[model samples]
Target: MATGLLTSEQAEQIVTTCRTAIGDSLRSVTYFTRDDYEQVYLRNDLERDADLSTFIGHEWRGFKTAQTAYEGSELGDYNYTIRVFDNGFLIRVTNESEGVFATTDGLTVKDFEEVATALNSFLGDREVR
Candidate 1:
């Protein structure tokens, strides 16, 4: 349970919990898995103009393992992408959209932080894989 080392099932549960914590702010959350990524949460109806998405992927490059959360959406009219990697994370805001922003802006920084914090806290308590 190292930082960003969530299994596919654990990632799904975390995403689901985070989505529930956000409550009615999101219209819906779709969960699925992909080839490279273990799980993904597609959050719709974030605000009046954007939807948020979170995806988890893990891989071992030689002896080092990398687990990360690839999150993207709009905090307001401006779009943002947050990449949460093991041990550290980064957030970037942008004015240009890759056409992923929806039509609302209800998702707030506080809300996002709450979810991220919860995930980080969960990871902090477990042994590193």
Candidate 2:
């Protein structure tokens, strides 16, 4: 397959893999189809403050408002935001309460792998979607 060009079947497979990996650590995961983009969004709860820094440091690259592509933080009682791109397949982490933390380059399989790795590391488990 070409980088970033996943057939519907491939995308479904990826999502299934993510869901299996994260299991209960994930509170919710959804796939959205927009006019020009397809996305996978995930959210999890925050049990401790340390979880905040640890998760961010491990999963996200850094904060970048220019991209506004990915953002994550504590929002109310939950900490969430794992956004995967449709066209580029880049991933972004955002804290709902805080802001954008990190984002990948584009929608290549390599980028998907990176996002999957970060999600596994941050969540301390594997999730397919």
Candidate 3:
């Protein structure tokens, strides 16, 4: 028997969508500027004892990996880190599992908005159990 799996493009689309949704919320809560790629960093400011997963959601496993290419630390029950890129954006999100991490290159603010809107629409149209 064969199981269904998401294609790379599909997976990327999902990640982009999720990021946009979170990004919009972040923007409303803070002030920041975007670089040439329209990328902005969202920092985590929760108390040390707070649950990180509540902020980043359950899908954080995608960015966390065993390779240790990036340095990370644990705060309470969650592992967290700062994601800094050459594009001048520094996002601090929780890292708990390993999956997929999207690159800031080739992604614009407009694209991020579109992805977020699409994800919101998709979820709204679906039935969650």
Please, what is the whole-model Cα lDDT of each candidate in the order they appear? Answer: 0.36, 0.37, 0.34
How much RMSD separates candidate 1 from the native structure? 13.0
lDDT of 2: 0.37
Clashes of each: 11, 23, 3
Residue 59 displacement (Å), model 2: 14
Residues 21-79, model 2: lDDT tens digits: 44333333222211112233333442222233343444433433423443343333223
Model 3: which residue pairs collide? Answer: 61-97, 61-98, 62-99
List the candidates ranked by TM-score, beginning with the highest.
1, 3, 2
Per-residue lDDT tens digits for candidate 3, residues 1-129, read 011233345444554554664453332111111110111122354223423333333224333442254445452333323344564322333212122222333345555445435644543443322
Name the regions of candidate 2 deviating beyond 4 angstroms.
1-6, 27-35, 39-115, 118-129
lDDT of 1 by residue, 54-84 (tens): 3222111210211122223333322234444
Candidate 1 residue 26 Cα shift, in angstroms, is 4.7
lDDT, ranked from best to worst: 2, 1, 3
